[model samples]
Target: MASFNEDGLKKKLDDLNMSQQSIQTVSLWLIHHKKHAHAVVNVWYRELISATDSRKLTFMYLANDVIQNSKKKGPEYNREFGSKLGKVFDHLGGLRLDDKSIKGLNRLLTVWEERSVFDADQIRSFNKNFNKDHSKEKSKKRDHSKYESKSKRHKKDVEEFEEIASEPRVRRESELTEHSPQDSTPPSDPPEPEQLIEALQELESAATSDAVVREKIASLPDEVSDVTLLNNLQDLNAARALSQKVEEALAMLEVYNKRLAEEMEARKSVARMLHDYIAYQKDLLAQAEETLEEHRQKQGKVKKVREELKAHLQNLPDISKLPNIRTGGLAPLPSAGDLFT
Candidate 1:
């Protein structure tokens, strides 16, 4: 229920980091306020333009996360970001980026293209704009390297392009393997409060919220458990019908019990996550308090030193009140003989 505005958005961006959790947290915040998608995208683009080169890619990752994840929720973010990406690429094309940054940007573009995040024509347009400068640089390199054999040069160029193009596929595969629940190790960082809340909300009715199912469970016939009632069965057909009813009741109860068990496990997982997250936060708070105490001590020492210096200065003769001696009125130095006497 947190409200979103331009200032809050900027503050979030200013603290944004490359960690997946950090990116996802901010993305969730933005998507939670999808009603302001237009303003959010505009602010996002503006910040991206002003961000240091090191942080620019992080901003793009955030955008990617929001646009892709918000699609199921609504098209607002995707549409808003889509409308601005061409200009974003154009701005990026003008910057003097290192090879790594260039490669990262290329990989993002590749992801968009492969996933059809935008229409083919729009993506093509974005690529053309983004790579305009890079293409020129490559052309110049090709021209300057005319002394090299054509086959060798072509091979080198192809290899470089392939390396960049193949990275997303390799990364995707590694991520899939890394994130498999069966193989996933505990995350190194604590879960954010927002993440824990979202997780708990998912389990709010995980055990089964069907009123009909609960009602059926509550009204289960006593015949299901009353073995003595078998004496009342007048024929094989009656016995068979009662037996089928017992089997059906058993099946329903089994299914509901399984659901309840799963829900229990889910809640336990969330509890573990919350426990870890709270411990982490408490540790951080302790560290912060220690730092504050250290700073307070230092400030006190500095203030004491300043006061002593001020007192020393105040007790000294004021230079301004002292008579100013002209060159002719100044006392002359004594001779070495006078000093001995």
Candidate 2:
């Protein structure tokens, strides 16, 4: 394995525009002793760390090198690198991405992968390790935007459901305000269990209608916040049970929303088809009108010729007064009286 001394590594990384701390953060992932004796400890370690995306690209390139060497020389190259990368990301402090630079990062990885420039096994191992650690941290993770839903353009059903849910909330707010003058009051009752069941049923129906059913189920924890109050109830076990049911319902709703999005897209396609057909028909109609006008002009010319021929026929001499002319016979010699006329 080709190795880099500290100065060589620094120069290479600097040329790639990596900041000092960014180098340090990624350095935590360096494990191939030939390259460097340094080893990584953790991913997020409890504080939000700032690193430009360029640094991450540099990290990925270094990673590709480390992993490739490990595949050919030793498996530890992939093993240690993935373990450290997973830890850092699993507990990621926070990341601010430059959307513009994201394109470059994506392109770099794509080109590298296409060239078979790195060990595919190393990439797979990293992903596997990351997901394993990610699953372990789910319960402790608070920022619940995994698989974030798309824009409202595709969220019709979800938006409608949210609207329905917010109505009773509004009424509760009014009641609270009306009774607020120097008086302590009991909190409003949680909605009836039947209402929850109905909502749950609606969500389940939606889920069944969706194409990506399993993904909807997986993202339920992140999508449902209204149900969390169930966990705070006095009867913890009952609350837990209700929460589970709500979670199931949320999964269904997510599925249904995705189905709705699909339906909307399908409708747009149909609309476009109809529009194109109408335009095509209009073009055909225009061509037909042009053809009709051309035919009319030709018919007019034919009528003029027929009229002239009729006039010529009306002006012809009376053949009954003249000698009969037979086919293939010479015409009668002109009389001397005709020649004089």
Candidate 3:
């Protein structure tokens, strides 16, 4: 495990790649140190601000992974990232992003919205900041269109052009053809070995690790639960004191219950992530093995062809040993009259 320090985290951010595995790996690390989530988010934002344009989206993906995955564990990461994401979006909106990058960010926003990762207002704010330039461009285009005037023929042509542009492209013959299951399915991108190890290790000490809370819940005083005992109370003051003790006990139980619920949810979330991760890795491994078999079959065919070609070559008379046709080494001439006789 890397040190839970700003410098170490910065180094990790510096090496981050725009792959799911990379994003998940870093996310797991952040979640593992979620006690320091506030500090982690601060470093993440600072690094994101300073990172290159190409690396910025990757940072956003990392943040999204952490926020979504760690939310069940606790609200620390969610709160920290929620506070900073608006500014991050503001920074991103200022850059000249490509269509792909824009779509990627939009997809993340959609996921966040669909998952209810943030409240409606926060998601709306993020969308506004992220799409500021796009919204402005659309507004400008609308304003421009209002002032434009054209001949009837030109207007018809423009309308036709717009219609054609809006229509979906026809698929090519090859693209329309049926594909095998393997071809239809996208390739899997499994996480690094180290990442899987770390994730498994983190799961070993999951939210259920708090035995103290469990102990406290188990050791509640009997007076709090035994209402029959209240019948024996001799005075109103004693009964009131008993009531106070009962109230305190109830309060403690309520707090512990909430904690337990959170822990249970966190455990379930980790289990889900692990299951998906493991399934993906297994699928990838199977695919790789299938590919390896295919390559081996191809190699065997190539080797057989080479051996056949070698045998055929060896069976042929050597050119050097054969008589040179140009030297006329054999007697071949016969006259027509000699043949008749």
Is candidate 1 or 3 superior in TM-score?
A: 1
Model 2 TM-score relative to the real fold = 0.26
Tens-digit lDDT string for candidate 1 (1-341): 33556876787798788766567567766766788999999999999999998678778878887777667667898789889999999998988775556666787788788878789998898889889889867666568755356445445544443432333211243553344333433322355578888998988678676678889988988889888877898999988998899999999999999998888768766865665565555545664576589889999999999999999999999887665586445577899999999
lDDT of 3 at 55: 73
**lDDT against the true structure, each candidate:** 0.74, 0.44, 0.69
> Which runs in model 1 stand beyond 4 Å of their true positions?
139-341
Residue-pair clashes per candidate, as listed?
0, 4, 0
Question: How big is the positional error of residue 175 in model 1, measured in Å on the Cα after superposition?
Answer: 13
- lDDT per residue as tens, model 3, 1-341: 33467866786788788655566556766776788998998888998898888677678777777776666568998999999999999889888765445656787787778768899999999998989887765456557754245233345533432322222122243532343223433222233457667766765555456677667767877777987777788999988998898887789778767766876665544444455456555644664576589889999999999999999999998988877778997678899988999
lDDT of 2 by residue, 93-166 (tens): 23333322233333433444555544576445434543443343444433555423422233553333222222
TM-scores, all candidates, are: 0.53, 0.26, 0.43
Deviation in Å, model 1, residue 271 alpha carbon: 8.3
Count of backbone collisions in candidate 1: 0
Find the 10 residues in a row with the least total lDDT in model 3.
161-170
